[model samples]
Target: MNPVSVTDYRQLAKKRLPHFLFEYIDGGSYAETTLGRNMADLERVALRQRVLTDVSSLDLSVELFGQSLSMPVALAPIGLAGMNARRGEVQAARAAAVAGVPFCLSTVSACSLDEVARSTAKPFWFQLYMIRDRAFMRDLLGSARRLGCSALVLTADMPVPGSRYRDYRSGLAGAPGLRGNLRRVAQSVCRPGWAWDVGINGRPHQLGNVAPILGNNSGMDDFFAWMRDNFDPGVTWKDIDFVRGEWGGPLIVKGILDPEDARSAVAEGVDGIVVSNHGGRQLDGVLSSVKALPPIVDAVGDKATVLVDGGVRSGLDVVRMLALGAQGVLLGRAWAYALGARGEAGVTHMLKIIAAEIAVAMALTGCRNIEAIDRDILAELGQDINSRL
Candidate 1:
């Protein structure tokens, strides 16, 4: 079948990937209420289409952090992408390169930063996790700088890993010590392609930037233990200052919900702030990132670039986010599904489809550029979205 959209790629991914892998990418935290609400809130935003305007020469380009982007949309930092396809992170980064957009590599990626950066033609952004060890965190930032990373994204939400039942059942999350090693071997045999292509041929599963701190295939349990011990629970604005001093580059603080946090991020001198709930993977009952964007946009004013990521699947959702005041949008599961479907080719196709969709939406709405989108074009369909935030 010819996959022409992200949804099409998602359908193909479900068929190609194992049940557990599919669920891990597709499912959110327990009950998935926030997951479902994220999409619902985006859909509730109705576009006020304008006619009789010449949008013939539409400009989707956006200049962020002094660099011009082909589009304001970027690929969110997705973890363990190597599990989706053979050398999946490399493939996805290549796709982002071809699409003329940025791809953020996660702290928990299966493929190392060096491998992904080497595969792509352009430099990409690196997302960092604030760990308890200041020295280890410093080393990770230094590695990113050495790799010529364009930006440093500090994810602030995950003090502790959320309980994902899907991963637990898939034998990927909570395992029974060394006994689970036997189970993993059996599962690998079942998925020979994954075993041979990713497990055998590709870089071994390890956080590339943190290798000196956490060594190779230390098993999931030990990794989780490391995470528990390393994650700084009392992360403050001072830590943000510390990172800024060390990196000396564009810094983005992700996982911000409160408008006060957004204001603080701007005050702390962040280049951008991502109004995210960790894609609904961390907190369940919290307001969706989309729903929380307007207030943050209002709070920060023009101090910093505001990007939001959560339940962002379609081009229409991208438009809605812009209309609500996001400088850019990020995708997590959408591209993950594409990577799972046909590796780099699928991801490239997905980007093309989204670009085409965005152009169409812009033409219909009488907007010629991403910067023209505003609150006047959006109408809320559900409970007062303004008050929800």
Candidate 2:
């Protein structure tokens, strides 16, 4: 296939990856109601078209967190994301750097922080969860600082992991012991391309950052068990202080869906807020990030930068998110699918597709720059951004 769209890349990814790995990236929590809503709600937003406007000149650039972004986009932190390709996180980071955007490496990434930092000339962001091990967390932050991390994204969700039935059925989780490993191995055997590329040749199979604690454990079962034991559920806003003590950078809080929590994050001094439902992997019935955006934007005013992620598959969706009042958009699954399908080249192509779409959408909508995007670009211009969120 020509693979001009993210959907095409997703198809390629599905065909090349083993079933368990594909399902791990593709599925959401039980029932996946919010998962579906994210894309559906963005599609529901109607763009107001204006022809014959002077859009001969267009600028997609935007300044975010003191960094000038080629576009208002960043790669969201996805757990086990690097599993999609051999040294996948490192490959994606290189792509993002070349494209002039930020790539936030997950705490559970396959490639360690130092490895990614050393690979890219532009500093990437780091995503952290408040695990039970504060000493470990402190040391990790120190490393990020030494490596010159540009920003810190605190994933304030997943205090307790959500229930994903797909993981259990595919042997990605739940099905432990020899049975699950055999099932995954059988599935891998069916996809010899992935087996050779990732299974046989993919080096440093364990979660790199936490590998010290994991020791000889590199299996999915071991990762799940570690999360079951280490993820801290008693975390509160006060915990941000501990994180602040270790490093100083733009602190972004992800997984916010309510205006109240948005206000609270601003109160605790978050530099940015990502209105998300963990790509619908953490919560099943919550509102989509698009639906949840307006009120949070209203609540925070200009106190912090507000970014939205979840169901952002194309450039048009990026325009829709900006029109709805998000300062920028974060991409999760789109980049992952691209990475799995064609490695770094696929990621670069997917981003090109989005950038082109954004340009066309802006030209048609009578805007020549990113700053001109607002509710006015929506068909429901006078409706106050539909604040029922």
Q: Highest lDDT: which candidate?
A: 2
Stretches of candidate 2 off by over 4 Å are 382-384, 387-389
Positional deviation of 285 in candidate 1, in angstroms? 0.4
The Cα local distance difference test for each model comes to 0.83, 0.91
lDDT of 2 by residue, 1-389 (tens): 98999999999999999999999999999999999999988888899999988999999999999999999999888888787888899999999998898999999999999888888899999999889999999999999999998999999888999999999989899889999999999999999987888888987788989998999988889999999899999999999899988888889999999899999999998899999999999979999989988888989999999999999999999999999889999999999999999999988888889899999999999999999999888886555666422
- Segments of candidate 1 deviating more than 4 angstroms: 182-192, 380-389
- Write down the lDDT that model 1 would get: 0.83
TM-score of 2: 0.98
lDDT of the structure predicted as candidate 2: 0.91
Candidate 1: tens digits of C-alpha lDDT, residues 173-220:
677677666666676667666667666776566655556667654665
